[model samples]
Target: MSESDLQDNNPLDPGDNSNLASGEGHSEDAPPFVPGLDGDPGSDQEEANNLEESTPVESDAFNAHVFEGQFEPNITSYQIIWQGSPNYWAGRGGNKIVAICDHIMQGSMESANSWFKNAASEVSAHFGVARDGRIYQWVRVENGAWTNGIMNRPDTSLPWLAEAIQKKINPNLLTIGIEHEGLTGQVFPEAQYQATLWLHRNLIQNYGIQPDRQHIIGHYQIDAVNRPGCPGTGFPWQRLLTDLGATQPKTTTLTSSSSSGGFLTGPVPGVVSGAFGPGTVNTNNAYVRSYPSFGAGVMVLRKLPAGTLLKFIAYTDQGAVYKGNSRWYLIDFTDKGGWIHSLMIS
Candidate 1:
């Protein structure tokens, strides 16, 4: 399906969401959760900070797209500044991103900048969207951040904990945490809301995640006794799904064989395919575009030849279809090495 097709699907429509207890994570759409334990987050705050040993961060001066990193932002449009934090696990241990958990800072962005940076704070969300709309990525999405699981090991087998207990993994391993500024009594900022909408859309799209409460959840869902009002009151839970259903991007797949006519030139001396791995290119040359889709106006990053050696870091299947393949691998050559279509490699 094309980008338009994704937008046309009402997958996230609030009307279609029914709160059915499926046990399996995101097997079906669920309705908005009504807050049950809304009170002072005082004790939970202490418990959360007391248990896990930490993780946010600072931004650089340069606004360059060509970054010095191993992974690139899935949502490329926003002004996302990489604020490296030290309090996170190295990787997800092969676990895919299953949920995007929303959280409330309950404090100012400046406080988050200081606390998330402090190792003693022992808490860090993957991404933080400020009230002013500045997006900060404290931890890479591929890693297990000390966001929700930093709290005391949840020993309770409450019905709400069905997903994590059943999966037999730390909640952090299965979810991406997003901390939004403000709390229950305050009105959620529209600017922050818009920024989060795009962030959620891009994040869920990358994993083909269902845009529902089961996947796009609040922190309260993880540990209700502690953070029952997380991402707090006034947050537009239903509207988030409705808006995403209408505006999410759709990657259309076109079936054809060897339609990469533009890549017919001879192989270059040291260029090759490494999006998925060191798979030698079978074609003459493959174009590394800035993003996934191939189009007239898309920016081509490199023209790699068949003989060039290659290696890869990660991949995403959300890319546009080419020769019946929608898979693209992320090469670690540089932040701008971009993506190579899977078919280009042998």
Candidate 2:
């Protein structure tokens, strides 16, 4: 909850932030190529309405700070369930933490968790809060989930998002997203509110995020044109800020760091880190294969232009050796996310 819990390794320059403002940012599978739009408000609100309130369960465990911004064994009192998702950028590609955005799943937490786990979906938020006050973490705070990627809508008038839009940066890089499992218009239960309140306070404390309307915002603010009712009108914004109660931002600057091509937090004690960031295509008309290998049965998903940006999710030697190298990288895309030989992206 504290920005202190998150780090800003690659602070975004106000100008370079503009380079990623609109398009060429998130993968195509991601939504809102235009603006906010989650079709049916709450496809399963009836099911969510019957939820029971849960007491905040205490815990002393930590998380494996997936990226530089988040520290391992996340410090929290509430029992947090961690389920790592592949649908996120390994790191912010150097952008620092700035705001925490809230979203309403309009469905069940189980659905959100399942969606995030599927790499083919190419979407994720950092945390998810169930109607019963249970907390679940999918993507790490340090990485950029596919949640709020770009401000592509024509109308960019929301004050809460003015600074973000003017900066012209990929909102996903600067923001940590927390999804609430519920509908847009339904009243939030006290237990759920308190749980989210604890998270917001911690984010403010750790990252130095100011406890205010602008810093702590809803998903609608970013793309009011399309998703004006995202975290819905029922979210108690004023109450959350009042409870947070730190009048001013704790610090003037945010800090973060990256490893393994700007991938993980530092090194996990036993897990080995490898190249896991964005890479440019080095070859001309390269094909992203259905599988990592070059031999039989592999289908060509599509062709890529030279210098096209590709998100390399993981590296392995499972594919047949190509160009005297066995390194094959799994790249995230709209179509089931294909794997490309390292030589094309090396």
* Top candidate, metric lDDT: 2
lDDT scores in order: 0.54, 0.56
Top-TM-score structure, candidate number: 2
Per residue, candidate 2 scores C-alpha lDDT tens digits across 1-346 of 1111111232111112111112222233253322232211112432132122322223433323322244324433566667656665555657678888888776778877767665566667888888888898776576666786445331232243555567655677778899888766677898788789877777776677877755786765565323445676667765888788845323211111121222222212212123354666654667766555554565666677677876654555334543223445666543235666654553
TM-score of each: 0.48, 0.51
Q: Model 2, which residues run further than 4 Å from truth?
A: 1-59, 63-76, 153-167, 246-346
Q: What is the C-alpha RMSD of each candidate to the true structure, in Å?
A: 18.4, 21.1
The CA lDDT at 184 in model 1 is 46
The residue ranges of model 1 lying beyond 4 angstroms of the native Cα positions read 1-76, 150-163, 246-346
Instruction: Locate the minimum summed-lDDT window of 10 residues in model 2.
Output: 3-12
